[model samples]
Target: MTCFSPKFMAFCAALACLSGQAPADTAQGAHVSIELNALEPIEDACRISFLVQNGHDTDIEQAVYEAVLFDTEGRVDRLTLFDFGALPAARPRVRQFLVPGLSCADLGRLLINGVETCTGDGIPADACTDGLELQSRADVEVLG
Candidate 1:
């Protein structure tokens, strides 16, 4: 019982151009990261899940998850959220979906962010705010 949507990617794309003390660039493409999973065929074959961390230490209090589709031409097409049969909390929550032939790279990171939140100390002045993780197989997919 979780909420999902495709509109979240729009938010991530906007965060990409930002440059400040903390950069959301760890995601490799945008300020967000996409995680693809293989699930047992209990229901759908296209098992996809996403985990989004604030690329920066801006203190993201809440946000929603989504699935975004991209073509070979580099166009973005947002897909519909799966019918989990329940609504997710109006905050940062985990969500999963089942899409058809979503390939391996057609998806992007989930977008979870609080609309109105108090900014933190803007990261420590002396501490190196940059952090990163190795890109695993679950991170992305490429559509043919």
Candidate 2:
């Protein structure tokens, strides 16, 4: 099952930022990309699913992704997703996050904040050391 917890997201947010890298930055030596696949309204909240593709020569054992949803009034909400198991090289892994009580109409933009803890090929490295080319989605609309 998908793990949906703000505390975990907060922890990831702290750990990822502590490494001294901007969320928009990509990890060097790691060919990884993020794509937002869906953003739909559910009740009062919205659900977002996306893919994390590994293009490097090594496998990705785990990753913590943080994203921010912004509204027109400047209210910001954080949505986080993670794959703590394994993501093979040149493959894609799908993950999802939920923004509680947030409507799709309220979303103005989506930003991929950062990626945390990338381990593979029997080594742990900083994926965001060189800055990532963030794949952010704008001009998005929710359809019923």
Candidate 3:
């Protein structure tokens, strides 16, 4: 028979317990993280890029979010819908939107107001919105 010390057995038990538990961030539930990846000025318009990641086990056939843009003075600039189509499970995708007549310099913040539509097989209706995490890499702030 193989021999294992008492301390080694205790360590093995701890490791087994940890392997069964999910990460701290995903312990609550699956989440969709949207990160404002970048903003670029292109010919009098701003190209906004978002890095989206689906943490769930099911693929999202369609995902749209109502977004609100704020100016430097914190005044609402505009509202629009961003369509991030076909988010595969546990995969990250970058989606870009070009806003006409808007400059990246004038943008203060972008808020994910709500989920306009989230549809997929065997997925919760609120899977895209619930426990959503918003982050920013550009100068503009992003909120959920």
Candidate 4:
């Protein structure tokens, strides 16, 4: 299952894409961004692995659970529209999600957990707009 809910996740995704944040009262709070970078295709089981970035202005003290992908064909009931995990990286933080048996070919999105955090120390607080990026061709070659 993906973190984004199919029935309503599209609405959330749209808000995030337009406003750079989940929709108003999305339960994702404010002043946060999720950038789904690379979704590297894996042949064996999953379609691809992802690299997500979580950012805030301050620091993350408590642990918040988050998930990526949102939805898939068969993986829905198995997992859930939302996965649970903790955010270890605080502000000025960019964490990567390495989902083993998951794919991102169809969906250009990754999973992320956002429960607790403080403003990070990345220059101008607003300067950090949590963004995601795909793995570079060079990096993929090295990993391959």
Candidate 5:
């Protein structure tokens, strides 16, 4: 079963077409989905892996995404930025980041947040304007 809630999925779907750029958020739109694959706890950091899937027919030259992690106190504990380069069409790209001093239990929630930049075929792309999805597993693992 999927770890993401239906409400969150709907939110992502609704934001998927937030832009009006051609092939970006238009009817003939391009889309991307972000999923939290795994969270690995290291010495003083959390190794986060995100699976970015390009749903558009065009190649995504680059995409900058954010992962907002809330702490146990329900406050914004850490905000991490991740970049996925050369994401080919219709393929899932795995991007990993090491967040210092973050544990799986410390994470209260994960937000797809937003895309900072997107490019396609050497030109600017509105991939994120169409909004991207985010999901996290209920059962997260911890590793030393």
Candidate 6:
């Protein structure tokens, strides 16, 4: 027969749980997350807001992405470059763009085509587009 103390059994259980989970840093991975925060109607245009987060340890001097907007009928509405300037490390910032001659209700989807420019002092070349995560809080869908 084998016997184990209560303290030893508890320690073993804790170790097993820890082993099943990934480390905190690696869990988030090395990437940038862009969240479509809101859409507002302004005059005859649509104001699109984005919540940008840099998960890297360094600052990003300039980050621009080629975005494509689709109409409610799933047809391409317009293509433009959104420049989110100077993203700080581990911080979130809101950037808004006004689409002239477009209505907020007509937007159905937003697609992140690719990274137009991602530059920083020590950041990787593909830091902005690599493993990019897209989210949306509005009715429109955001895809990468």
lDDT of 1 by residue, 64-102 (tens): 333346544556655444322222111122346666655
Predicted candidate 5 versus true structure: per-residue lDDT over 1-144, tens digit per residue: 222675765555455434321233333345666667887888888887877677677788877876577776778887777787778876667888888888877876776567777887643456664645456555532110
For model 6, residues 1-144, the per-residue Cα lDDT tens digits are 122676665555345335532111443465788999999999999999998888777889999999999999999999999999999876778999999999999999999999999999989999998888899999999999
Could you give the C-alpha RMSD of every candidate to the true structure, in order shown? 14.7, 14.3, 7.3, 13.1, 9.3, 8.5
* TM per candidate: 0.31, 0.61, 0.82, 0.34, 0.69, 0.82
Off by over 4 Å in 2: 1-30, 79-85, 128-131, 136-144
Better of 1 and 2 by TM-score: 2
On lDDT, who's better, 4 or 5?
5
**Could you give the candidate ranking by TM-score, starting with the highest?**
6, 3, 5, 2, 4, 1
**TM-score-best of 2 and 6:** 6
Q: What is the lDDT of residue 46 in candidate 1?
A: 49
User: Where is model 6 more than 4 Å wrong at Cα?
Assistant: 1-24
Residue pairs in collision within model 2: 23-113, 25-131, 25-132, 26-131, 26-132, 27-127
Worst lDDT run of 10 residues, candidate 1, spans 83-92
Instruction: Report the CA-based lDDT of candidate 3 relative to the real structure.
Output: 0.84
Better of 1 and 4 by TM-score: 4
lDDT of 5: 0.65
| Higher-ranked by TM-score: 1 or 5 | 5
